[model samples]
Target: MTSYPMHTVDTAPAEARTPLTVLRETFGFVPGAAAVMANSPVLLNTFFSAFGHFRGGTFTPAERQVLLLSNAVANASEWAVAFHTLEALADGVAPEVVDAVRRGARPGDPRMAALSGLTVAFIEKRGHLGEADVKAFTAAGFGEGQLFEVVAGVAISAMANYTANVAGPPLEPAVEPHAWTAGTGAGA
Candidate 1:
């Protein structure tokens, strides 16, 4: 396995320190996955900016979690899944909804199911979403603009998911209860 440095604001490069601090302040701590990415200031900055954009977009907190959790699951990223699962639950997404996404199934709610399905297809298709996919997504009552919103969410989720998979960032204790493996049925 390739080892990546897990950075703290004090130890991170000048450019990375600010973002790491922002992450720590906003999230109450810097996520390990973000810290690992801090090895490259550019990568860390890009991740932070894209994540900020997604957070500032139109999706509700629950919708954002669905996309991110689905992305983590699609990438088979244990660490990202755990982080997202905790955030999703805290955001008041139903436990069943998070569970279904962890299990690679859609949420019971039709609208959520559509969002999850769109995220899966978007990831699996590698952003070459077709008209049919768009039609189905829109049929779920999301607007065409939200499709673009999904794109932004996917970008952030993909970065986090791939980073966690590649670096195996340690799960924070707060999220340990939700720690997950790719196929082990959520967490222990």
Candidate 2:
């Protein structure tokens, strides 16, 4: 079903994959998607490296998860939301936070609400938010740095999501069971 064969380290090309080490070091297992992206590890590592750089910044880890979920929900990617939502909950976000995000209420939690608002504006405006929107989110207390991280989150998701859609990669055996109810590719 996947455009590229779902591959393990043994199947993926050997030399191109600093991402293999990057993912293994970060998550303790090389992610299936990372292995697939290893066809051109440049593609995988470019985004992964950008994520590592953003992740090293000022926002709390919880805030990062919020931004991740906001983008996933906006893309209507249940596959994305499912994995990231579990990560959010593990980081102590309430289940209501996920539910609120799904229903488009900005999720009530402050960090996530900011993320949700930013995500909605970015998607709806196609990345052209007005000055007032920036003022409003800044009013809500997300600093300029976190705002940038949110943008980075969207960028990373955009890359992985379109790849996954066209690839139709089978959900990783681990992430499979967490699939959520909304997505562009549901049952397709």
Candidate 3:
């Protein structure tokens, strides 16, 4: 198996150092996956850029977690699943809702179900959303603009998810309790 270094802010490449430091300060610690991704300045920067845009998008924090967790599960990315599970819970998404998404099922909450359903379809269908998909999303009270926001969330999650799958970073202790295994979840 390939191994990757977990870089610290000071240890990261010059171009990656600032972002690493910022992430550390923002989250109170750098996520393990991001630490590994710091090996490639371009990859780390791209993640940061896309992530920044997604955070600034229209979704509330809980809604964003729903989309991101669904993306992680659809991509079968264990690390991202765990990380986003923690974030989802911290962001006040219902525990049942988080559990449902972690299990690759729709949430009991209608709005969350819509977000998860659309995000999974976005990844699973590779952006070829059918008319029914758009209709379901909009019918759930999401606007057409938020459909595009889901695209942004998916893009950000893909960067993190794909990196974690390839690099296999160790899970941070805070997220370890939520550790996931691909195929353990229904459609994961």
Top-TM-score structure, candidate number: 3
State which candidate, 1 or 3, has the greater TM-score: 3
lDDT by residue for model 1 over 84-187, one digit each (tens)?
89999989899999999999988899898999999999989998988999998999999999998998888888777888898998888887899887876557
Over 4 Å off in model 3, which ranges?
A: 186-188
The lDDT ranking, best first, is: 3, 1, 2
| Cα lDDT tens digits for candidate 3, 62-126 | 99999999999999898889999989989999999999999988999999999899999988899
Model 2 lDDT per residue over 1-188, tens place: 56686555566666545667767676666655566677776778787888888788776777777777777777776556666766677777777876677555677767567667887788778889899778777878878776676677789877665566556555556566556656432321
User: Could you give me the TM-score of model 1 versus the true structure?
Assistant: 0.95
Instruction: Output the lDDT of residue 41, model 2.
Output: 65
Better of 1 and 3 by lDDT: 3
Once superposed on the true structure, which residue ranges of model 1 sit more than 4 Å away at CA?
none
Q: Would you estimate the TM-scores of all the predictions?
A: 0.95, 0.85, 0.96
The CA root-mean-square deviation of candidate 1, after full C-alpha superposition on the true structure, stands at: 1.5
How displaced is residue 156 in candidate 3, in Å?
0.8
